[model samples]
Each structure stands twice: as C-alpha cells, then as structure tokens.
Target chain A: MSTIVKVGMADLKVVEYPDALTTLGLGSCVGICLYDSTTRVTGMAHIMLPSSKAIRKNENVAKFADTAITELIQIMESKGAKKTRFIAKIAGGAQMFAFSSQNDSMKIGERNAEAVRAILKELNIPIKADDTGGNFGRTIEFYSESGKLLIKTAGKGIKEI
Target chain B: MGIEFDRMNNDIIIDVLREIGNIGAGNAATSLAKMIDKKIDMKVPVVKLVDFDEVPEMLGGPENIVCGIFFKLEGDITGSIMFVLDQKSAINLVDLLMPRDNAEFDEFTISALKEIGNILSGSYIASLSGLTNLQIKISVPALAIDMAGAILSVPAIHFGQMSDNVLIIQNEFIEVLEAKSVDGYFFLIPDLDSYEVLLGSLGVTL
Candidate 1:
C-alpha cells in the first residue's frame, strides 16, 4: 500500500501507485485533485486565490488557483499521467465573507470557483464530481488506487465522491 | 438635517490612518507570531479616506466582507475601531495558521478566518486599551453580506446620521513561508451627544 501524501495550501504533491493524495480545510479556496486511475497517479493542490495578478509577481505562484491548476496538470502529466485520461475532482469555495458590495473583485470566493470551472472546461477535463460553495468549509481526500474521493464538510456528514 | 463636519482631506487622513494602521496591525502580527513561533513582516498599511460611494472601487469588487469590531481607549478617552479584510486575505491567513494540515480551502478555512479575526481584533483592542488606560468591550463579529450597509445600519441604532464619516486603512502581511494582503477600515460614527463629547475632547469650541 502506498503512503498518503498530504498537500498544504500553496503546495502540491504527486505520487504513483496505491497512494492517496489529500488536502484539508478548504474555505473560499479551491482544492484540485487529479487522478489517473489506470496508472494510480494522484496529485493535489490547495490553491488560496483564483488569480496571481492580484499578488506580487515573484511570490508563490502555486498558491493561486489559476497557476496552480496548470502547474499541477503539467507536473502530473510529466509523471506519465495522460491528460485525456485524467479525471478531476474539486472542492472548496465558500463565501466566508458575507458583506456584499456592487463590485466583483470582493466576491473572490465565487470568482475562484467560477474560474476553476472555466479552466477545467477549457482543458476538456471532465469534472467527475465537485462539492463547492456555501458558508461553511470542507476537507477532501482522494484515493489513487480506486479513484475514490471522500469529502468532509463542516456541520455536515462525510460523503463519497 | 444633520450638521456636516468639514471633510478631512484624503492625503491627511490616509497618512494618519497609515500610522494608526501600523500600530494596530503590529499588534496583530505580534500575536500571530507568538502563536505560530514565526517572524512576520508586514508592510506599512495603506490608508484611504473616501466617500461611501467610492468604497467599491477602492476594495476592487462587491462580495462578502468580514469585519472585526474593537474599542480603543487612551487616557480616559475611548474610540470604536473596526478592521476589514478581503476574502483572499482571509483564506491566505487560514493557510498560514494551519500549514501542516492537508485540508482543502473550505468552510473549515473560513471558520479559521474568524479565529484570526478574533485574535487581531482582541489584540489590537487590548493594545489600545492598554495605551489609553480605559476599558473597551467588543461585540461578536457578525459575518454579513453587505459590509458597508451593515456598518452604517448598526451605528444608526446608537447614533443618527452617523455613516457619513468613515476612515479606512489597507495593509499587507508577509512571512517567510507565505505572504497575504489585507485592508482595514475604521468608521467614526458619533451621536449628537457623542459628537459633542468628541469635539470637547479635541478641545474644539462649538
């Protein structure tokens, strides 16, 4: 059995064979889990924001949802995971802040979620299942061997994805 | 009609707010640093004093805003203070607080934001109280959808026509492991009686 590889926010980890990739405490942020069931290759990233432009250019680029997703995909593909065969499962994107204004930038949580969907669609990678959006937070675990996804939400029960 | 006070120029207000923001943010940074056993470096806060209509532009968009309320006291004087941070900053903060865990960014992280808010609000208020030698109580931070409207409405209950005067300060937080950007705003709403008291305290003759 492969050991579980845990990834933190702004970080990513990839492993081959029987290993489980996991990330926890997703709030307004997005966690993208990519798994190649045939090869048992799994990768996960906990991205904090949707865009990198809002932050300093030289900063941690992996922390942003957009760059992180692309990087995760490239890294996984480099490890012999095929892009066409990879299935994506995502979680997080809570409206942690309740104050609504007329502006769009502040709705970062929503924007992050929207951006993830848009990016995934453009890549032609089908999102097999997703748990996103709300006032609460979530934790996600992805199993590479069987492509089993376990999701735990705040004040809510665990669910299989 | 409520009496209109002379508007403070943006540059002057911003400068004053930047100084105050540094002090308040410094308190928060110290608290977090002690908790995580890491050194935090924060840039000098950027302050902006703008009309209510201009807040949207300054903040960059309309979404949920989280606020922490605190009271500051200085030598028998008391002031109500509030801190506001953007959603992105909130997420980044949660990530920094719980770095070892492999949790996705979700409600757990948002809940984590409240914890940071509590620390920041509590510590800053405590610092202000310590400096001022007065007692200050803070209300439980309420996460609301419309922050500006909520703040204006709350002050109206205690004071009439009080939303017009607001002070805002923005800052960035940086540490060796990560960096997060955030902003805070202080709204000064005084009732007719409190207004008189404030003016009196400032030694202004009505």
Candidate 2:
C-alpha cells in the first residue's frame, strides 16, 4: 500500500517510493516538494515564513523557507536520496485576500515564493513546476513514485505538475 | 510578552477572559439579529490558547469549506479577527440578506456578504474598545470562500511569526428560524504585544 503522509502548516515529511506526501489549505504559505526519481525518495515542507532570521522564535525549522528547504534536503539525503538528483516542485503561496493599502505583512505570499526561488537557486536545485501567487488557497499532493505534484483549489480546478 | 501567562493558570483569570468575550460577542449578536430581523441566540465565548496545528480543526477540520472574513485589528491593539460561516450558514445568510431565488455568489452577493462582515466586526471591535478604553481601529474587511485551513492560515501565519500559541476567543451565534438551524463563528486573536495594552486598559494588570 502506498501510504500518503500529511504535512501540516510549518511542518514537513519524507516518504519512500510508492508513498505520497500531501499538505492541505495553504494560504500565504509555500509547499516545497523535493524528489529524487532514481531513489524515489520525496520530501515536502509547509513553510509559513520566508526567513527565520527575521523572527525571534526560531524553534520550528520547517516553518521558514530558508530553514525548511535546507532541513528537507538533509532528511531526504538520509533516506538514500542524492542531493544532485533533487528536482523541486512548489505550490501555494497565494494572496488569499486583497487589501487596498498593501502592508509588509500582507505580501507574505509573494515574499515566501520569492524567498524559496532564491534559496533553491543558491542550492542549484532546478524547480520542475512552479505555481505561485494569485488570490486563492491550494491543497497539494505529491506522489513519490512518479515525482508528480497535484494542486487543487476551491474554484480554480486541479492541475498536475 | 502578552498577558502574563502565569495568570492564565488562575481560574479567576479565565473568568475575566470570558467576561471580555461576552461583552464583545453579545453586541455583535444583537446587531446581527437586527439586520436579519430574526431571533439570534449567542452562547458564551470559548477562550483558549490554540496551537497552529489545531487552528484549522476549529471549523470542522482544515479542508472544510467556509466563508471567512478577515480583518486586521490596528490602532491601540494589533491582531487579527475572522468571522467564519460554514457552507450551509453562508448560503442561508446570503438568502436572508439579499432575499432571492437560487442565490448565487455573484459579485453583488459577495459585496453584500463583505459589508455584513465589516459591520459585524466593526461592532465587535468597538465594544472591546469601549470596555477597555483603547483606540482600536479595524482594516477593511477581506472575504474568502475556501477551505477553513487555507482561510485560517492567514491569521495563523501572521501570529505564528511571533509564537506558536495564539489566544483565541471563539464565539458562536445561533439563528432560530424554525426547524432549520444556522450558525456563525467569530474568532478573536489579539497580537501578543497588544495583550498588555488590551488587558491593562480593562484594569486587570499584573
């Protein structure tokens, strides 16, 4: 049986081939899916913030893009996945609501996506599929066997990447 | 730091929180009752320290579809407030407010619902300001129709930047319209820094 593991907000999980990883209802939070097709090892992190350095409490490693990506890669490596074979697919990071005068905090979704993009570039991990921004929430599922990510929305319908 | 966590251990402190919720929610319920011209019954607010993981489950798990109205509380206090209604209650409310056959959430329906949220949240915040003697201002209401977890992540991420624990005041309003039942929820979350200013104004300083 291919078990599907759930990754909560500010949380993460790693699974082997034939297994899947999912995260529900992402708003202004980014879901990072890292997969090594050769080993069929996959990892997902539900990151809420762009950087942990800006915040005081730094206990939750999976809560920030900077920390979560690094941590996720390490965990995937431990599961017999090589860093060079890593392919990234990201979803969520949506502006769930619109406001007239945009505040620094209100643009978190855009910020999170940007941060993830930059960090992945620095790490030399090429993103296979990218779906970020807009005013909506997303529930994403990542299949480890095929390294495919599925994105579902309330009204926008579903798409695979 | 927010209100002295040490005090939360006291039963008397919990009662004070309850009183605060009653005053604000009571006013909100009355205004809603008048708007719909229906009898509305409100239960005592449930106040607790909720973790980020438990937030989505507050309204029938994270994936449960809900109509959530978000407001950024500004001025003397800074935090976030959300008024949530399940799919059934959302449809019932739209029908009650606009009174039409086969009401769809067209532009007009959404606008009406946004205004309703604005008015209700304004009243709730105003009541708190009156009780605490604080200058609380609310931002324009933002409405989202999606899964509860997604809707709630906005506030959770906002407050999550500071602490994992968020203080929540969950208020339920029941509308008595015969056998069919309808309900709505108000979730009040004060920013950690605002707690000192909020609690101090009510003369409950430690």
Candidate 3:
C-alpha cells in the first residue's frame, strides 16, 4: 500500500506508485498531476506562478506551472510510463479575488486554469476529469495504484478527483 | 514632484508604516480568526526606512526566505511592492490557519502559506487604497527566494529604482500555540515623472 504523499505550492512530487501522490489547496494556484495507469506511475506539481520569465534560472524551476508540468511529464516517462497512456487531471483555479468590477484581464484564477488546459491540449494529453473554477479553495489527492483521484472543498463536499 | 520629507521624517514614516502594518495585519488576522475561530494577539508593528544596501542586514542571512511581488496600478502610473516572510513565520502562520491533528508539516501547511500570502497581499493593497484614497489595482502575488543580494542587484528587474523611498514594516503575531515575526517591505519605485505625480497626490511638495 502506497502512503499518502503531500505536495506544497511551488513544489513537485514524482512517485512510481500513483497511490502515494497527493496535492491540496488550489486557489489561484494550479495543481497538475500526470499519471500512467498501465505503469502505475504518478507525478504532481503545485505551481504558484504561471511563468518562469521573471524568476532566476538557478532557482527551483518546478515552482512554475508551465515548467513544472513539462518536468512532471518527463519524469513520468523516464519511469517507463508511456506518454500515450499518460492522462492529466487538474484542479484549483478559483476567482478568489473579490473585485467589484469583472474584468477579463484581472481573472488570474480563470487564466491559470485555462493555461493548463491549453498546454495539456497542445501536448495531446487528455484531461480525464477536472473540478475547477469557483470562489472557494480545493484539496486534491491522487492514487497511482488505482489511478483514483480525491477532491475536497469547503462547503462543496468531497468527491473523486 | 520629488517628495522632500519635511512633514514625513524618518520617524514619521516609521509611524505611518506601523499604522499601515496594523491595519493590514489586522485584516489578515481577522480572516484567520474567522477560519480557526481563535483570537490572535499581534505585536505593535515596527517600521523603518532603509537604503537598498541595508536590506540584507535586516533579513538576518536570508536563508529559507520567501518573497512575493505584486504590481499596483493607479491610473496611468504603476508602483510595485514586495513582501518578504521568513520560513518559520510562514510555516507558523499556515499552522495557525489550518491546525493539523498530526502535528506534522504536510501539504495543507504549504497551501496555507500560499493562501496567507494571497490574503496578506490583498488586504495590504486594499488598506493602502483606503488610506490613500487611490483606486489601486494589485496583481496576483508571486513567490520568490529572498536572496538579498540577488533581489537588490537587479535594479530594473521588476520595478525601477528612480526614487529612493523604501518602507519596512515588522510585525509579530502571537497565538496560543506559536509566535512568529514577519516583515513586509514596501518599495515605492517610481520614475522621475511618476514620482512627482505620486508626491503631488500625497500632498507632498517637490
């Protein structure tokens, strides 16, 4: 039995067993998980920022959403996980900002979620299920053994990830 | 409109920064209080204005530090502010928001820190707008390492350093389980023309 592995914001976790990897509290930040059901390999990343342009190169590159997702895919493939079999599941992109005016440009939560969706689409990886968008935060867990996902949000009840 | 600090001396600036900290931290504390249903006692906020060179010394070696930068736009002009929090304070703050039964640092704790950063930055900008009566808009908070030399070396990286005004506010938050101290630095980096405009808005003469 693989124990629960918790990942923080701006961090990444790669495990051979999908049962071990889990991520939580996705607000404006994004939680992306790459898993291969055949090989039972899994990788998760919690990205706080969208891009790494402003950050230094020597810094931890896995903290950004774009770079982290790419890195996670590479790591999963290295563990004998096939790209064709890999599927992506994402969560946590809430419009947490309570601005009076609704400006499209200012919707970072929506933008982040959209960015992940677009990137996954470009990579040809299908997103199996996603629980994104709203005014509340979320906690997500992934099980590599069964490729099972668990999701929990305040006042929203718990569901399969 | 270069602000000649006659009325806003170093001491006065510190006082103002303290007041700002009180208001900003108070807002965050209220939210945390509501989340955990526990009251927290925050120390009197300490404020200082230091040169760019002095930033490293104040942060005490700069290891395990996290920085968040946000740009605030007021009409045509924009100003940037950075918030720096130490590792211990960051973890403690998260623990306060989401107390775990296991007493271990978990994913929930890290997420809590990010959320805390979000709340602090949001409340700080909102309080600033309320205080200055300026329609300020803030970007989402982005996290960074608090390497002092690296942060100050790149002068024009995020915000230009045309103006020599920097405000540092130190706050201590005390709860029943843990106590933590964190610093919030506000750098008013404005171009020559924008600096003048900002000063004029603040009722300071050039």
Task: Give per-model TM-scores.
Answer: 0.50, 0.90, 0.53
In angstroms, the error of model 3 at A38 is 0.7
- Give one digit per residue, the lDDT tens place, for model 1 in A1-161: 57888675457888887788876556566778888887777888876566666444315555677778788888888899898898888887665434423234235557777888888898998899888877555667888878878987644778998
lDDT of 2 at A75: 93
Residue B21 lDDT, candidate 3, scale 0-100: 68
Per-prediction DockQ, in order?
Answer: 0.03, 0.64, 0.02
Deviation from truth (RMSD, Å), model 1: 15.8
Which CAPRI tier for candidate 3? incorrect
TM-score, structure 2 vs. true: 0.90
Poorly placed runs, candidate 2 (over 4 Å): B1-17, B96-108, B177-180, B204-206
The collision pairs in model 3 are A18-A143, A18-A144, A19-A144, A149-A161, B1-B196
TM-score of chain B of 1: 0.67
DockQ of 3: 0.02
* Best prediction by TM-score: 2
Local distance difference test, each candidate: 0.59, 0.83, 0.60
Give lDDT for model 2. Answer: 0.83
